[model samples]
Target: MDESRPTPATPPAVLADHAERMEKLLDRLLSPQTLCDEIARPERLRAAMAHGLLGGGKRLRPFLVEQSAALFHANTDAVLRVGAALECVHCYSLIHDDLPAMDDDDLRRGRPTVHRAFDEATAILAGDALLTLAFDIVSSDETDLPPTRKLALVAGLSRAAGIGGMVGGQMRDLEAEKTDRPLAIRDIEMLQSMKTGALLRYACEAGAIAAGASGDERARLRRFGEIVGLSFQLADDLLDLTSDTATTGKATGKDAAANKATLPSLHGIDWTTARLRDLVVEATDLLDPFGSKADILVQTARYIAFRDR
Candidate 1:
């Protein structure tokens, strides 16, 4: 990594365009019903699924997938479908994460958390359904990706969402809470990297593969993904310290209450803020080889690090 490089300033206008494209893609991708009529118990499950998956969020993960595909000039529809599948897996994690036994939050995306909107049993089953259906969507015959690449994307996503990745991270988070451990800064970073960053990294790589990216390009994007994922988690931790509930669209100060070690909590706001800036610079530098083609991605990575909400 270069010791110094200017971070790309994401122009408000360009950010708006990216935001608009992201919103439209999310609407189209998530609009499809989860359980079809052919399924015997569609309605009940569908309601539970929609309760958490629908409504609004940043949709950042899917947006990363779409933008990364654009980097390779690939089929937007293929990327959108794959991105949507990733969103399902993400939504499932959030649903399970907010359960009474987990984060215990009653709010998400400006609405009730899944268990609050429906029964706990239904929420549990809905999360399970989304998790299984995510793989189904990727592996289904309808996915337009080539067989080899399709298998690769499926494998990458499964690994990120499973034991070594997101779930394992969550387990560590809970254990941290129980022990009241005052974590080292590096340990906190690792916890979020595994818990939150893993799937985000996978989303970007999956998009690149969907576009038939070369081996070198895939490796470059992986590095970029890892940096941006850490930046996002750091920003989230910073927000927990500074933002209000209304601004964040969720409860603030929850991290401190849960005894979670976070960037600002561990390193102080000034240091964490500087750390975030460094990461944005690092991430944008990685995009230099792609030149002007990756300008939007570079800008978005900055946005992920700096955006207020």
Candidate 2:
């Protein structure tokens, strides 16, 4: 079912002003070739890696990182590396999620999935490479952050992407797939939080942490992350139901066929839509402490739920 075009709720004017700064930062950080063509076998793997990683994603996670870093008055050049590093991890997850043994997706951000574009084995290794490469980028000397701050960001990302976070949630989702079990709304929330929200939270929090934010600021940022994170996942669920393959760049209605647990599956579309609105509102409220600095984050949260593609 195609939903009507969503309103283009732009990010706050403050954030909009820094769009060029963030773009420059992203360009600088991600400019390096991920492929080290020095070795022959690694070259082939790098090609597959580039194919998946270079695709045009919404770049939402990186945007969160850049915006959060800006809150602490962090230098754009110094903090943009964190954004690039987060993209590496996000790309890795998508590669794995599109694997044959996983979602078995033939398409990603409007192109063939890594496995389909390349081969299954290459796709698996490409994901592994990106995953490890993210840590390398964060911990590298080129990061331009203080040693202590860099270490904290690295540890936080490790925890968020490892067994305690995304991986654990994936296990829960896979187990739920073969069972006759029914999940409560709270349980569904937890699952989505861990599966999708973990990295997003990390993206926001780590940016603030890297910028040497105050304890109060970090606490507020965490709350903001939670709300926006949930909103992001809910938006994804809504898109699966309402977006077409042409716009989404992936097969529509995969969740229904896979019997995946989603907000719309647990509750009707109306309820899910209402819940998304509430989440976005709550997310926007969390940004009040940051004053005008958080306008972009707040507006972006509302845009997530309202976006159709």
Candidate 3:
């Protein structure tokens, strides 16, 4: 059942198409009928959740999931569901991250943050709902995955999104910000990997799990995810340094203002750029086993490294 085929369109086009489809899917998934019984979903809460979730993004993590799954010819419908679940977690993180307690940002994806648009209590509830909904989507029968695979996906996502991963990383970042001394390179790496890289890594790993890929293949994709995750953070730091809010659709220069220890900040712009190129080369090399079937992922790695926003 290998669904791999020659794609005539360029990589960016493929990514755009994927993003469009994912947007539509999310719109439907967040609707009243699809989320829960009508009586259980409160009006304002649903609106807040939609405001946060429907906000525009590149949808890069889900693209990673879908492309990774394609390498193994996994079921299209099932993988899309998995991608949606991952996106729920991603959006949830953004909502909570923008709260007054966290980064305290006023804007997200070119719109007012959920907490700013709605009350803080409602924003908190929306984030919690999205996080919980991600698990429900993966574990529910609608995913079209076997029980064992579903369990594995749930476990992987929880670890990536929970403490000892993203949450732990966030704690470290907050602590680092409080101190006058800057974090060491190793400490910053660990923080970034956990906070920003965990779910992205899981995005690739989850695809392999859904496809029943061999351990070696799974491990390779996991490593690729790790590299891409690092590159992603580096690029983000660069954008924060160089781009404006108008271009990035979010606040810029917050990292330096907060004294955050990002690789681009630690190393100069030239060094960070070189490192990003190296990471992309390394990531694409890992996919050589899949040949042209992995072209989209290869392009995705480059995009992650060089994206303006």
Ranked by TM-score, the better of candidates 1 and 2 is 1
Error of 3 at 211 (Å): 1.0
Per-residue lDDT tens digits of candidate 1, residues 1-309?
A: 333322323433444454466556445434444345444656777778877776666677877887788888884667877877888899999999999998888888768898998879989999998888788778877778889988998899989998889998999888787785587877777788889989889888887899999998898888788888988887788788888988767678978886777778877877877788888788888888778988878888888887775
lDDT of each: 0.79, 0.77, 0.88
Model 2 misplaced stretches (Cα beyond 4 Å) = 1-41, 242-250
Please name the candidate that would achieve the greatest lDDT relative to the true structure: 3
Q: lDDT rank, highest first? A: 3, 1, 2
Assess candidate 3 and give its lDDT.
Answer: 0.88
- Positional deviation of residue 81's Cα in model 1 after best superposition, in angstroms: 0.4
Task: Give the TM-scores of the predictions, in the order they appear.
Answer: 0.89, 0.86, 0.93
Check candidate 1 and list the clashing pairs: none
